[model samples]
Target: MMVDDRAGRPATSSGSEGHVLSTPTLLGDRYQLGEVIGSGGMADVYLAKDQLLGREVAVKVLRDPEPDPTDRARFMSEARTLAGLNHPHLVTLLDAGTSADRPFLVMELVRGTNLGEATRRGGPVPPQRMAEVGAQVAEALAYVHEAGVVHRDVKPGNVLLREDRRVLLADFGIARLVNDTAHHTRVGTTIGSPAYFSPEQVQGLTVTPASDVYSLGLVLLEALTGERAYGGTPTEAAMARLNRNPEIPSTLPAGWVTLLQAMTDPEPTRRPDAQHVLERLRALAGGDDAAATQLANATQVAGATQMMTSVPPAAARPEPTTSVPRAEEPAQKRKRPYWAIAVGIVLVAAVIVALVLLGDRGATVPDVPDDVPSQLRDPLQDLHDSVEEAGQ
Candidate 1:
């Protein structure tokens, strides 16, 4: 359910068997396919009518009708994995089968845009709302972690924003099934999107739930900052992380700065577990459950309405819109630019160290990111940069 770009591509119908699909197609004599809703690298999702169930469902069909046994096995693994998860923060897997050896799955049609679209439309999410969304996603991640699964790919594109303005973390590791890294690596293709890849994953180490937490941290950072922490060519972005930490901006709520730093810590072991992350985020959301319940009900109503109406093709919805972040917090609460305080702390520490080392020599301190490692911000580097700045 990575319902946006980068998780997969949109559909291209060449023919019925190996190419594009036709509308009004019947699958298993029970589901009536309408228009193609979403498409990714390996599958095409359609808004379809579940005739037997008397409801609308998102039907995902494999593009390759005659995929090899390995592909089939991987598809079945997604089915098996999804069958075990029943969290409200996840996309519900309804049914699955093969027609002419083409695999397809019937899913609960979540009538909402993905987080990528939402963020682009709404800009940076408000602090409280970000906490609510992140908490919901973390809760889902906690459940899957307990179930012994890792959502290797956790990005904004895979997160859905419901009509009620809440969100759900979708796909639950399904991307790993189709994103075969071996061949991609052989051809110099990145194993995953560099902007969201964890350090361990980029390093080719054994990925665990910790990796998922790292990816989640990046996604949360992007949602809150209205910017990606890393970019450039895939290799450059991934390798950049090996030397430096994410820029936690000189602006952010204090709690968010602390929580995000902990979550995105260079050492995976230092990062908090999903449940702990969920607890912290829930605290940030201000212990509200009634509002969340109302949001869920809104989503249910929206889904029901979509079920009754005919869905337009993906092209018809060129830009999916989302609700603006609620900006009604009282003035007593502060949120923006908390990272300025962090910078101040780093500056004070640096000055104290410089005074101790310089023995009262009057010299200006150089500016740097708050979290720059001591090794990179060594005395020599600072002296060199300071001298260079003075000359300029």
Candidate 2:
């Protein structure tokens, strides 16, 4: 039998291996640590199960050399910030407490891969998919912004893609509560990914929603192009963000170009708000304008062809006789003209009916004149007659 140090399962210890930290029988006797998920400068994240709730969660424990009074306060404040935010796209903070002299945050366990891993494994995502991801993240940011929180780090690694392909924004580690103590980010201390950091963040200024939008644009760019919009190295990345323009990929959807441009605008004020981004995404996804037009044209052509094939030939009418009794001849002659006119009118009506039926089959009909030419205006005239008959 072998023991897994991370899972805290009992196992045979090998003398050759270094001693592992004894798994504490109790993490405040509440959360049962499972496996290490990830570690960052401030904390180590673990897959944990909450014994009380019998539910899986992510536990992020502060690193050793516990945070100073000020840091601890800030950490607690972050927990409060997460507690206040109620959004589907954000990771929900379930609980927070001090355990073994370390502050830990129990968060909703988000299954599936992060954007970074997905991008690395599969090339750039499709433009439509990228738009979807961006829109979702933007909505999350919008919610946090409304709560007066600024997520200082909005990079690909913090964005997770779930099994159902929903985008979830995670790891709000460096996020700051706007109403809290005034703490300006130190200059030259790069907080977010250089490739995705906005110019304002690079300048060590207080980050805003616009900064998040700028970072999201970079993520979108990478997702669409399958490569960083800036450069390879950190230094190059920073410089690119500061001085270079993002190269628009030819494969990107035309409607989305404006959206990307607005997102990556150097001037924060010029950028579109999250609400606007959401609207645009909805429009694209629901197949508005361009898509609808294309579909209408396609259906119209098919309808016209189908109508021509299904219509029955006009029924033959008996021809009026020329000869009759002398006395009745005059009456018959008079009736002949009337019968001829009625037959002509019936033939015209039949053509109109055929055209209207064809038009009703999804073909767009042109406007009809009051005295339309018999040969050139059947389709439009037929539509008018059908409408008039329906009203009657």
Candidate 3:
């Protein structure tokens, strides 16, 4: 039987409502809750300060009491899975314990937004930024895979970006420890975001590291194209994964397109592992640098070609008149026309302007106010005064 929660129905276990504790305040003594950061059907995350460490941290608390044996087992498994991971690109699990009647996890508080929010507001990031993020995430996955864990829920919403722009994979609540199959049997249904789920996950097959890579490919595709690789409603996102092929974005870089295609291959055996993906992305980034250099060289060659073509041909001299006869037929000297001179001057000026524009292409120019002197003790005083006046 299922019981209806705030959103809808969820699998229910036999437990009294009194067993679930109400919200308790433990701010300054243990963790100081700043505000609610996020909430979902299963848990709510809060921005808090860890009094013990004197640093900010995020606390995620289960929505209901873990009195039920099944729920308690699953919660314990999650804690064990997180405790086993120690990677720079993964959110550090600081502490986990039962507070009051709810099970809670303390994690590193990321200052920046999640990938989902970033992509929605800024569209796709630059290729270089995407590659950097992808590489870090791949490395994080590799580390976790080596530890014999499979992250069943890898998606954009679960990937956090730190203030320094580093990627931190979050939400290992559903991750299964390799030896915890007994606990996994209790968690009845799939626990991953539909849009980024691997095909095997949709088919109810056991998840592996390659499954993580498949999901990572979906995330990378979204990061590069500002759109989901599969088209469907939110509820249908998982169903779409069962299809043979996902649509590739037309605007993605050639190398990235190839990488994503390999990652999202339907057959888990055919898909590349996290380590392989990391190496490929690193190589792609290096190749991009070389390609940029080649483009610059090509542009220079084209400019040189244009300059050579524009040069006037060598002046042709009439054959020397061996015979100095026929003085009457004096050679009429053609005067250089004023219009020709004007045209030449205009061409030279245009070339100078073009060169100036090209030189400024990659240069950063500072903006100065008209009232500011070229050199002064406080040239910015007028600007400050203007700002103050505007505020007034």
- Among these predictions, the greatest lDDT belongs to 1
C-alpha lDDT score of every prediction, in listed order:
0.65, 0.63, 0.63
Worst 10 residues of 1 by lDDT: 304-313
In angstroms, how far off is 237's CA in candidate 1?
2.4
Summarize candidate 3's per-residue lDDT along 10-113 as a digit string, tens digits: 11212222122245457335986555566654666766777777877777667675455665666667778888788888888888777776778888766666
Tell me which residue pairs clash in candidate 3. none
Put down candidate 2 lDDT per residue, 132-215, tens digits, no spaces.
777788789878876767787888778887767777888776787655565534444555678888876765555566677778
What TM value does model 2 have? 0.65
lDDT of 2: 0.63
**Which one wins by lDDT: 1 or 3?**
1
The local lDDT score (0 to 100) that residue 351 gets in candidate 1 is 67
Q: Which stretches of candidate 3 lie over 4 Å from their true place?
A: 1-24, 27-29, 65-68, 185-188, 287-392
Cα misplacement distance, residue 110 of candidate 3 (Å): 1.1
Model 3 residue 285 lDDT score: 64
Q: Write the per-residue lDDT of candidate 1 for residues 35-124, one digit (tens) a residue.
A: 676656566777778889798888888767687565566567678779888898988998989777688888887766776777887899
- Give lDDT for model 3: 0.63
Model 1 TM-score (2 dp): 0.65
